[model samples]
Target chain A: MANHAISACAPDASIESYIRHYAQCIDISLKQALASSNAHPKLLEAMEYSLMAGGKRLRPILMIAAAESLGAELERIMPVACAVEMIHSYSLVHDDLPAMDDDDYRRGKLTNHKVYGEAMAILAGDGLLTHAFYMATLAAGSDAVSLQRLMLVIREMAALAGIAGMVAGQAADMEGEQGITSLEQLESIHLRKTGDLIVFALRAGGRLSGASEAQLKALESYGYGIGLAFQIQDDILDITGDPAKTGKAANSDERAGKVTYPYFLGMDESRRKMHELTESAKQAVQQAGLPDPQRLLQLADYLMQRDR
Target chain B: MANHAISACAPDASIESYIRHYAQCIDISLKQALASSNAHPKLLEAMEYSLMAGGKRLRPILMIAAAESLGAELERIMPVACAVEMIHSYSLVHDDLPAMDDDDYRRGKLTNHKVYGEAMAILAGDGLLTHAFYMATLAAGSDAVSLQRLMLVIREMAALAGIAGMVAGQAADMEGEQGITSLEQLESIHLRKTGDLIVFALRAGGRLSGASEAQLKALESYGYGIGLAFQIQDDILDITGDPAKTGKAANSDERAGKVTYPYFLGMDESRRKMHELTESAKQAVQQAGLPDPQRLLQLADYLMQRDR
Candidate 1:
């Protein structure tokens, strides 16, 4: 997997350096997005704590990179990038609530609810979710993107993150936790829960960057293939990856009796499926005829092989 | 108060009839907004439970009436009306969670968490909030309202309902719950928590209807005045109104030991202040030079005299 990632990026620097650079860019934008609003101090504090807590920031990077692949300036789409990350962070905070997953820790730090009280945590999540739309409204225009296109991006982002999308996936996941026994049911949960937002991020980037309908269709296919692979890799890592590397306890899913890709398919079959999906994702990007698909291809490989 | 309300409506029908008619319009719109989504049945069930559970539909009615007073067709801005109500309902669901106000009932029905369980209730709120932006994007255009104007309404709605507005107010109210004593502090909380959204509803209606700068200013002042009066009356009702009429327990605010207008000011002083504010609100609407300010004037009077 590492060899494939390196070979995919041989024409440029390694995927590691690219991810690091984009991650730093995302961090700065996220901070600026949350900066010193006149909002209540404690609420801002809670929002900042979860937002600033480190993660791969993979979603925003994919958004920016996707736009960049289509020849758009990074600054033009920074707000959309930050908005997606804000939505992601808010979901995490709510997911960790006592009434939800009841998680005590996340990304090696105390969960939002563990540090802030449950009420504050809930409000923090609410604030972040509302502010994501507020941030998206700030997505300014350039030669490549019109305000109408930006509005379309905002509309699509909201839909993908909304009830029929991410929230739907979450609701289904909560319901399925009582014992989802079929692979189809598991896929249904993963598709809505994880796939829709990933597709939105890529499609939003494409739409904002003036991709043709055909190109956007290719990106949609690419996003779906990789989204499923990503979740399967997550499931595999839960069983085999080191806790220190994964930022979560190993075998926890099994202990909780949660149905996952590996649990349904076996570790070897899950790995095989992930590899096939990654190949398809890369092929989709290649077929899109984008000016620069190398970075996305490398991203697909990197996601499949990441230790953490 | 009753005499003032009757006199204010002498130019038209009673405000009570106007409210009932507009309330039905809002109910139909709200129902349409929530219909036929492919979201999880349980999640949608929870959202619909809180959303369709009856309230006065006051905010949406105010928005529609304010727009209609300026001669904008109600159908043109129905999306904004429904969106505002969605935001309102989402807040109530989250606020009634055990981690927040912990209420068992709302609008005479079981609170969302009480029926759906906490995790589902939280997801339900998240779903409705996101779905509101989705619904707003669906606001169809007409010859009278431009897309830009509709976008502005959506942007302002999100801002007012987001951090630094309603969410900020909620955070402050939560913080202030630990025995806030000053009248100024209490006023600050009320302005953000309850007042901003109310103001947004009125301003949204005016903006969508192409109100002049002078008229917009009048609506702004009118919103602030009535927003305060609305809360003051709510506080007074908590102390004196019948539970059956209010659909909530009497004196619950006092029992909760939360700060309120009447808690800081004497009942007579609070009543006097509410009356004064209501008069100012009516005057502002009257001064706006709208074609039909009678409904708005009567609304101001009716809000002050409402028993629930």
Candidate 2:
């Protein structure tokens, strides 16, 4: 029944195929990036373990798709795409630490800290974060993007992932452990935590491809909508997802007293809200007059209908 | 007696004056950099607490001196200088975490983990590291350094600080905690752990100042010599310096069963090796034919004679 519902929502399966295509390309690039790193063997192993752990590759795909929408070549943006994934992977590594979320498993495998020990995991996170920037800077050598544009992309990536954006969300999530006061607070936390990086991915891709202000704004809205929808889906999955499929124990959020959309708005309302966001994200893409909004629109629908 | 001996070694005293001058400039720039950051208040506070904490600020000072040797303006390299110090500061914060060094005090003040708790300290460290690159990228906006030069510096900074250098050393040190078998291993650890960033400081400064290949190589040799000497001094200080002065417990390394220069070569030989390295470092600078090598030469001698 769930499969049927998803198929009903995503009438075009081409987006799913494209995601697989992009993921394969990104996997190859990510491997190439780490294989050349002469880090300590143990550290390298830990970093590889987490980075190669199965993921949706959503951020990087969004970046590539955004750039493609602007008629930019994939080769030019591949480094940046890989970089965003690295940032995401590093965040997951740190977020799984004993000092942080203390998760034992992720994606049905032992977390980085569990496998490599707390200290190595921390360094792995640090290493990945630093290497992400190193990878982004490599994009500067490409003739496709101007140095000034690359600088803006680099600066925005740092700001979005640093204290002001992702770090701020992490800090708030920690502080809010006492108790989340309102829906506004929860939304704000997710907006900065999840939305900022998503926005960075899309905007960076657009800017690299010489996006006009209006086009950049459209991508931002699309990114913002999808980011919120993604988080909402995560919240929904915590309540309804299978441990085998989601690679995490269901209801863990509720057990941990974590605030989520379903917790505040109830399951039905949360589902409605998520679909609404996804609908708006698709509309934003369609209205942007991009040369290729089809891929982005299909991606939004595909994400909205995902089981995990 | 120690003060008198230092004065005898550094007869000019002008380098000490220069250190003080450069340190003041760095402090102000660092403060301004953080003041405008819109990071979460607690995260910002944690970053500010450690960044503003008193220390030698040697890395940034070295950067400034290297740039000054090539007649570069202070305003142009100040961002990179501050960026290096930020990197140094972040490493200290993370190194003091309970999972790593378990250090409670640094520079006579409570460690970040000790004051802000472990999780915040971790985030604070991440914030600083990311912001360091952000700070470095700001230099791209400066007219003094070309975009290509700035890219090289940023890449080097990340490499030296990331997996291949500082992180590699840290991993090796942790893995060797059971027992460091040889002096060579100890030297290698310190060379990457402490040396790479120092080398980065000098090279980046020189590069930003449009240095010739020979001048850059000279700075590399000078940096390596001082870097080794610096670690040897740290080992000696761990054994002999006052806790009040050094802001660390004497003989802590010995207590931790960590290997050191003195452990391998004995006190007399360690002292001799340190002085020999410093002498070579001074000679490297003097022979570099830089427009102004006096500051670099004097600083090397002054560092060699320091008690803490």
Where in model 1 is the C-alpha error above 4 Å? Answer: A1-11, A140-145, B1-13, B140-145
Native-to-model Cα distance after best TM-score fit, residue B239 in candidate 1, in Å: 2.2
Q: What is the lDDT of candidate 2?
A: 0.86
The window of 10 residues in a row where model 1 chain B has the poorest summed lDDT is: B1-10
Q: What would the per-residue lDDT of candidate 2 be over residues A1-308, giving only the tens digit for each residue?
A: 01111111122557877788778788888888888878789999999999999888999989988988887766767788889999999989998888888899888899998998888999999999999988998877434248778887988998999989998899998888879988899999998888989999999889888888898999999998999999998889888887778777889888888889988999999999999999998888888889877778877888877888
User: Which residue pairs clash in candidate 1?
Assistant: none
* Predictions in order: lDDT: 0.83, 0.86
lDDT of 1 by residue, B170-272 (tens): 8888888786879998888888888888988998888888898798888888888999999999999988999889876888887777778888888999999
Which ranges of candidate 2 are over 4 A from the true structure? A1-13, A142-145, B1-13, B142-145
Model 1 lDDT per residue over A1-308, tens place:
01111111124667898898778778877777777456688999999999999978888888877887787766667778888888999999999998888889998999998898998999999999988887777764432236667667777887889888899888888888787989999998888888888888999888888898899999888898999999998998898899999988989888978888887789899999999999999999899889887778889999999888
Please give the range of 10 consecutive residues that has the lowest summed lDDT in model 2 chain B: B1-10
State, as a TM-score between 0 and 1, how close model 2 is to the true structure: 0.94
